[model samples]
Target: MTGHRARRLTAALFATSGYLATIPTANWLTTRYPAAPVAPGVLAPAGVYVVGLTLVMRDVSRELAGRTPVAVAMAGGVALSYWTANETVATASAAAYVLSESLDFAAYEWLRNHGFTIALAISNAVGLIADSILFLSLAFGSLHYLPGQVIGKAWMTGAAVVLLLLRRRAHHSGQLRAPGFSGATPKAVGRPMRRDGGGHDGFGDRAGTPTHPQQNETASEAMP
Candidate 1:
């Protein structure tokens, strides 16, 4: 597929996955895993969920489709989550995503020059903090799960960093596209071609060089 098309498909896929993660899926290993508390009553392992992928990928989506797609994804995710997860959870999740994703997008724009992983890492960190606070406070009425939430989301962000790293690898490997979905192969951004052949640019050597009448006229009067 073309570069942009690949990037779009990737963004859509990741966005959907992040949204779908909202609905708690049954883990065959452990059913309805309650807060097992990772630390000494600090937080429960069950509370540590991998739902933050939405925020992470949302940042990636921003780079691909800019702010519009990211906002739309957040809205679409919330709408879908409403039917899948409980209304309370969905509301809280949607609000958290909207606030956090928007923040992430803005931050990324300024910090992205450092690198993809670095940019997403920083943005995702902010997003996770916001999402954790908002969701826990609004949905559960308790920050008891905040620590666990952060931990859970950290894993998701790490995975996103890996993806960014991969994309950078592809970019360095000569893929001129920004790794999204699109129509045709994208042309690489490159430097302009130079007319190195014998031509009097009117700045330097004129011997054995052909010069245009307009250029020669301009140069002769300017120099003489």
Candidate 2:
């Protein structure tokens, strides 16, 4: 493979690996530590912080690896959770992971055309809320941890979004090359491409410059 393509593949694999690892890591954390208090009277899983990072990584995995592979990774995560966590935590995690991820996937896909940052923020918000409610209810048989869960996940999501926005801004400002869903490094935003597919060379062709004969042909006439 070309060096660029190989690099892209490597990045995708790394993102997928991170996504797969987060679930089991969170499960193990819950198994190892006592519940942490998030509010005066509320207690959330000690793994809440790691699970928050998992949501952000999930979206990144989808961007890099595409949908089907991410689905398989989700299954792998569920299996790992079952092995690493208590039966109740595993069951609750599985249910919440499947349902909340589905909601996140759907919302992200629908809003993706709007903008990456906007879609990510909204989808993560939806997923976080659904995950907190379902997992807390199923695992503890109550919503006592809901507030803590939401607050923790929101902090992670907001921080992740901010970092990504800064990265994109750097790319747009010609300070970096951003990897995006297109599998190509993005060109600096607002810079036009030439007809020959190179960076813009000049403001415009000389006023009387001869144009390619093909350029003068109408679109319908040029078709084979």
Residue-by-residue lDDT tens digits, candidate 2, 31-59: 77648865577677888878888888888
lDDT of 1 by residue, 1-224 (tens): 97746755776666655544443431110124535554465663352445555565566555555567556666665676656556666677667766886777777767665445567788778777886788778777888777877777786668767775665455434422334312242222221111331111111111334544344334323321
Give lDDT: candidate 2, residue 11.
73
- Where does model 1 exceed 4 Å of error? 1-48, 170-224
Q: Show where candidate 2 strays beyond 4 Å.
A: 37-42, 175-224
Which candidate number maximizes lDDT?
A: 2
Q: How close is candidate 1 to the true structure, as a TM-score?
A: 0.61
Residue 145 of model 2 has an lDDT of 72
Local distance difference test scores for all models: 0.54, 0.70
What is residue 179's positional error in candidate 2, in angstroms?
A: 18
For candidate 2, the 10 contiguous residues with the lowest summed lDDT are: 197-206
TM-score winner among the candidates?
2
Residue 162 accuracy (lDDT) in model 2: 88
